[model samples]
Target: MTAPSAAHKPVRKSRAVKTLGFRIAALLVISIVVVVGLATLAARLVFHKPVDPEAVAPVARQIHILITLAERDPQAAREAGADVRDEPARGRVDPKASRFLKDMLAYTGRATDATVIREPNSPVLVASVRLKEGNWLVLSALDFSPPNVWPGFVAWIVLIVAGSGAISVLAAIKVTRPLRIIEEAVESVGPNGELPHIREDVGGNEVRATARALNRLSVRLKAAIESRMRLVAAAGHDLRTPMTRMRLRAEFLPEEERGRWLSDLEELDQIADSAISLVREESVSGDAETVALAPLLESLVADIAAADLPVTLGRVEEVDVCVGPLALRRALTNLIVNAATHGGGASVTLDIIESQAVIRILDEGPGIPESLIDQIFEPFFRVDLARRKTIPGAGLGMLIAREIIERLAGTITIENRDPRGLRQTISFPIAGVADGLLSAQDVECT
Candidate 1:
């Protein structure tokens, strides 16, 4: 078999254990153990009161006298309360008491394998020593017992656990810092669809890298948008010269054909105007304030009805939204005109649902085809080709309306109404909320 080539060799992935998060997690766990150990050591040093060697010095002297007395007079030593035993000693051992007694006994020329054990049943210390004749000399006393230090040990444990918890929380926050930054940046998007500026120099390596990437994307998007607007505006300006010349030439056509020629020229003029209007909606930004929906809806209906067009105001709620008043009015006017022109008549209504101020415009005209519904927002998209000359639109109304609404930080959705009409809905984030109770306003169909 041929040796595997370097290109064919599986790439070695960096181990998860080597990641920053894993290291932080490992350090956090390791820190808990270290803290516990330190707390235990601190407790021992601060709270544990060991038996002082001096405190048991008398016990040592008593054991030495008992051993000497036992060597000569076993009965007198018994009278001195020295318990004599032939078996090995029992109970727990006291190292401090044992060490003190050993040094004292060795000084008096009585060095022996001795131990001091406390009785299992009482608060007592017992000193044990083996005599030269193989007998065990034992003495018990109450003065050598030590104080309880368990309470101090418990306190240290509590402090260690609390400190470990705090460290864990800090590690979690640090790990999620990038995510928090992303969420905050998205939430702070302004009414003009402008993203909040991100600082690249701050934060950890991962966070700084994310911020840099987002800032680059934002810069690229702004450049693309500006380029598109410039191209549209320049194209619109170039078309006006030709359109003016066409209009002048159409004025000289034969009397029978002059009307039709002028009508086509007028349609061309409207298209240029619509294109420029779309560009304005994309590039213009400033002077945003809360505009109420009720008065705006009423005024639009009145104007359209006065023009002898089929338009009506339906239930309008007194609600406000943050947006540029003129920009908002222009967007709504386009939608209302589109609905009234395409759908025989338009009925507009405004209501507040949840924290959103919703506007619904219903028209009785034949709705758009289901197959072409998604393309309705595309610029210059027309579903009914036969009506292109019959209707007076450049097919830019829906696109412009959508652009304006979205730039104002709102949403629009169009769906076919069940029986025979189209429903266009626009939603905006309500500002300076009114009580949930909608205002009572009766409006008749025009």
Candidate 2:
């Protein structure tokens, strides 16, 4: 192939950047290092002028004695020790001593200069004084050990560490707050059918971009579902007119042939009606309200029993949930009917398990083959073509039930029971209103 154009050239993707948590941790580490570094630098600058403890005590003592002697008698004090010199002593001034000792000597009416020296091998402290007689005197002391830092250095280190830790914690919370909000918003989208918009004014560029993309996806998904419902409605309505016309024409056929013709037409009409009903149920939005599930299920079982169907309600707990009552009842009715049709009879029981309201529908007829169990919930799916002749359904019941249950934030599962028959289990989150209820009692529907 020829060389690709610049526009068509494959671009190499850069590696994904670190997550927000990792970046925050890195920032914390860097901030700690910078803080510690600055604290160390400040300590160095404050304590650059060092003092020899071994020399400071003796030097201060000797300076005091020299000032006292000069005030009494200058010539006698100078002649009392050979270590004392008249001319200025060879030494550097001590910054600390200049602040305190020099003032004391000046107050005594004696002019003096004090110095502390720290060299590689020799450490010395010296003080030079001028007497009232215009003569000079000097006092000297020797030190052995090396220079040492100020005592407050350790305290400064502790303060820096504590300050860094506090700053890091605050920074982490500031950086992750927006992410937590986005996470909750994304999770609620499935149950509520709408994604809450994120505040793009906060957080980093990548986070804002992700929020915008999720919002777009949510809008598109809502539109697509609405479009599909519209199509199903239109198709169901279009098929009804032709089916009605065919049923009308079937009436003129010979009596023997008319029955079969009318039966087929009626089945077609029922299928179209069922499709429309499913679409309507899926599209309808109803306000959620607190519902007592046990009473609702008991009434449903009573109605089914009155119809002469083999159904019974077993032990049921007084559990409440927030759901659209009409939708939940319809979904439960469909599950009951399916169990009765396929498995001959259904026995339903309810209980509270691990903070969830659990409902089980057990049956006593031949169980479905394991291979076809998963396919049964698909729209228009039937386990066997032969059974379709006897069973009058468009195979949308289970699919519709599942949709309704999931929309209510519940789960439904079906499995073959031991020996023979199928079991359908449904679980829903219990509403807060159900707390502190009376003990559950066995419910009988006769």
Candidate 3:
């Protein structure tokens, strides 16, 4: 068999792993950002120092005058361009001349930030220094640049964040591995698939609870199916005795009486037989041995032809599949009968399509209406609108066939041919097999 392709199958990502990864990475990033910002501020405070005080005294005095003037008659300060300042004269400076001098001398016995200036051509700098009077001496120094303390902090933060994110992703993989396994197993646990065993129990209480629930559900489903099958078997067995007695009694009547009674009895017999067959087919499991589909198709074709149905094997190929021999045979027989009866016999063809064994039986009879396709497989349903037919049947053949095919995880479909006919297609999973020749000497049942 060929491998499943992307078109036929889809790849799904693990939700648990993805969620965990994002959460861990985000937390680490936030932590790094906050810590890095605080550390940068701390480093700046630790390394900061004061510049020379002498050169700053005159500048400080000029700034103090400008503040005093601005606070009183603000327009006077603006008109005088009072914010401008220059270097002091080389001499023993008079501390009393500077208004801010007294405040500086009382603290470090010095002066600083001696001026404030508004120069249209130059950039401005603002500085603040503590004084003895519990006040501050403020000034603007334009010629110099402040310290750069942010680079080290930002670099460390980037390093920490990147490292944390990488570590978190790896850790999330380890943490969510168990949940991923459980998810995959849960996904596989359906009517057509088997659940796999979950290994590595990591996700706390929630994971354990989910696992427990799944186990309980599995057990409940098994019991329910078993109970249903048992009921069907018992019902089928009970119906056989009465039906057989009726058939025997109908045969003992007079010729005139027997004719009408026999027809009714025969129909009832067919109904009972179909019911029993349906129950048996539905109850069978998929533990049967594999069969070579080529010979099986050929044999079925021959048997159908022997029944005077114009059935012929068009093209047969060898494809082995996992199926119960009896059940598979019955399913094919039902399809053939359905085709022959309603579709006026058919040319059966079998071939493999994309790893699936497909059987197509084409007939020339009037095809079924599109609306009735779904109803055809239902038991007791008849496509014959007039309800006048020589062959008496309970309409359980297709139902039984459907059940048998489903038990083996196969499918059957019917479609209309171009020139007014029907085509029945049955597809089953193909197992590995080797091709062999068709010998004429082999048994042909027809």
lDDT of 1: 0.75
RMSD of 1: 14.4
Q: What is the TM-score of each candidate against the true structure?
A: 0.57, 0.58, 0.56
Compare candidates 1 and 3 on TM-score and give the better one: 1
Question: Could you say which candidate leads in lDDT?
Answer: 1
Question: Which TM-score value belongs to model 3?
Answer: 0.56
User: What tens digits encode model 2's per-residue C-alpha lDDT throughout 1-446?
Assistant: 12123222222222221256556756786677677768777867787765434435555556667667876876686577634445656556556644445554555444465544333354555545554454555655444333454455567556766776677766766677556555655444543255545556666776687667767877887788778888988998999888878888888888999998887877777777778878876665455677899999999999888887789999999988866788889899889988887779999999999889999999998888999888878888876788777977777888888877876667899999899999999988788633322111101111
User: Per-residue alpha-carbon lDDT of model 3 for 1-446, expressed as tens digits?
Assistant: 22222122222566666787678767766776777777777767787664456666665455555555655664585577543222322233223333344444434434443422334544553443333333343454434334454686668777877887788677666666557655655544433233333322545665666666666665676677667767766776777787778768878988899888768766766776777776665543534566888898888888888988777788888888766777889889888887887777778888988878988888888887899877888778887745535665777888888877766657788888887998888987775431111011111111
**Model 2, which residues run further than 4 Å from truth?**
1-186, 191-194, 433-446
Candidate number with the higher lDDT (1 or 3)? 1
**278 Cα displacement, candidate 1 (Å):** 1.5
* Residue range with the least summed lDDT across 10 consecutive positions in model 1: 437-446
In angstroms, the error of model 2 at 253 is: 2.0
Distance from true location, Cα of 424 in model 1, Å: 1.6
Q: Report the Cα lDDT for residue 66, model 1.
A: 77
Error in Å for residue 9 of model 2: 45
**Error at 17, model 2, angstroms:** 14
Local distance difference test values of all predictions, in order = 0.75, 0.69, 0.63
